[model samples]
Target: MNIEIIEIPKIEDYRGNIAVIENDVVPFEIKRVYYLFDVPSNAKRGGHAHKELFQLLLPLSGSFDVVLHDGENQQKITLNKPDKGLLIKPKTWRELDNFSSGAVCLVISSDVFKEEDYIRDFNEFLEYIR
Candidate 1:
């Protein structure tokens, strides 16, 4: 399992800062864009992994913890800044947790929603990725 944090270059102006995502800036061809926000406490999300789609996740508002496991290997990453995002490659099981109050997560996907492209089970994901 490999995880990488991508730093988005921020440009500061008189009003605020801006970060842009041009095509092919990262890996894979982006086909879908979505965001997760207004997450309530005492709750967890993203207990699945895509079989083919890759994702670049950014914490636009606050912070959160992303726990990843590939059966034998496990790791956790904390995302807290808008200028930085995590690149979740395909075939890696993931779970998002420890969301700070009012944390917002944005995701850029390599493909559209396809049930066959998702590996919803951790054990299954581990086997498939191998």
Candidate 2:
């Protein structure tokens, strides 16, 4: 499992900063965009793996932690800055947790939502990877 944290191009001025993300920023082309917000501190999301879907996660507001597993190896990464994006590859099991108050999670996906592409069970994900 190779995860990359990319720094998005940011333009700063007296007012605020703007981050720009184009099609070429990630290895996979973006086909879907979604965001998670207004989550409670004890709430968690994303406990699954995709067969062919790739995702890029950005912390637009506060912060959160993502745990990635590839059946043999695992890693935990924290996203706390708006200027960075976490690239999650296919076949990697992921779990989102430890969300702070008012945290907003922005996601860019390589494909649209497909129920058949998702492996929701941890045991199933492990077997599929093997």
Candidate 3:
């Protein structure tokens, strides 16, 4: 329910188009940047929730489905556009699946990677939120 779709700024041109993410665009000072690629179609990614981290996922190429749950509500969002981003807030569980061929998911994080910050169990996540 706290998920948000962010529209990245784009510069159109005859040659090509450019999408940029400035400091003001992402709503946080990015601490780490990463991406998911070369994922098998049958396989899935992201089966956890962060306690205090914020992330924005962008489909840089191809497409994929993002399943999000905020304890009481659940939603599935398909990411297929490079200029559009999915904002994931804290306390929400997420899972990525249905990846098209050559799908590339770019992630912008608000905090560094910390295993302790992740809630990998769905029941734990729900209990934590409650």
Candidate 4:
């Protein structure tokens, strides 16, 4: 998997820390944003890949592991710092695991919600990306 680590600048003030993800930050424009929080114990998520949209995943609260698989290769990323994010290009299968209790996983997507844009099957994703 061609995983790229994106270092996000944290803007900290008296109130709290703030991080912004604009269009020009990465290669793709932002069109959708969603966050995963209050996950149960031992629960895994995100077993899919986008066909076109790029994704930037950030752990806002605790820590989690992102497992990236590209057919013949696989990589695991342990994300704990809030000041950094992972930039995942299109056509890579990702799985979220080892989520700490009450951890928040924020996702910034490059496109709006489209069911047909996702490759749910690992073999299908491998074939489609190839």
Strongest candidate by TM-score: 3
Residue range 1-130, candidate 1, lDDT tens digits = 7678888878989999998877746688888999998787557889998777789999999998999986678999999989898999877788998888989999999888899988887778877877
Worst 10 residues of 4 by lDDT: 20-29
lDDT of model number 2 = 0.92
Instruction: State the weakest 10-residue window (summed lDDT) of model 1.
Output: 19-28
Pairs with backbone N, CA or C atoms under 3 Å apart (clashes), candidate 2: none
Tens-digit lDDT string for candidate 2 (31-129)? 999999998888879999999998999999999999999999999999999999999888999999999999999999999999999999999998998
lDDT of model 1, residue 96: 90
lDDT (10s digit) by residue, model 4, range 1-130: 6678887766889998887666566667778889999887599899998888889899999999999987778999999988789998878899998999889999988889999999998889878877
TM-scores, all candidates, are: 0.91, 0.96, 0.99, 0.89
RMSD of 4: 1.7
TM-score of 2: 0.96
Best by lDDT: 3
- Tens digit of lDDT per residue, candidate 3, span 1-130? 9889999999999999999999999988899999999999999999999999999999999999999999999899999999999999999999999999999999999999999999999999999999
What is the C-alpha local distance difference test score of candidate 3? 0.97
Summing lDDT over every window of 10 consecutive residues in candidate 3, give the lowest-scoring window.
20-29
Q: What's the true lDDT of residue 25 in model 1?
A: 62
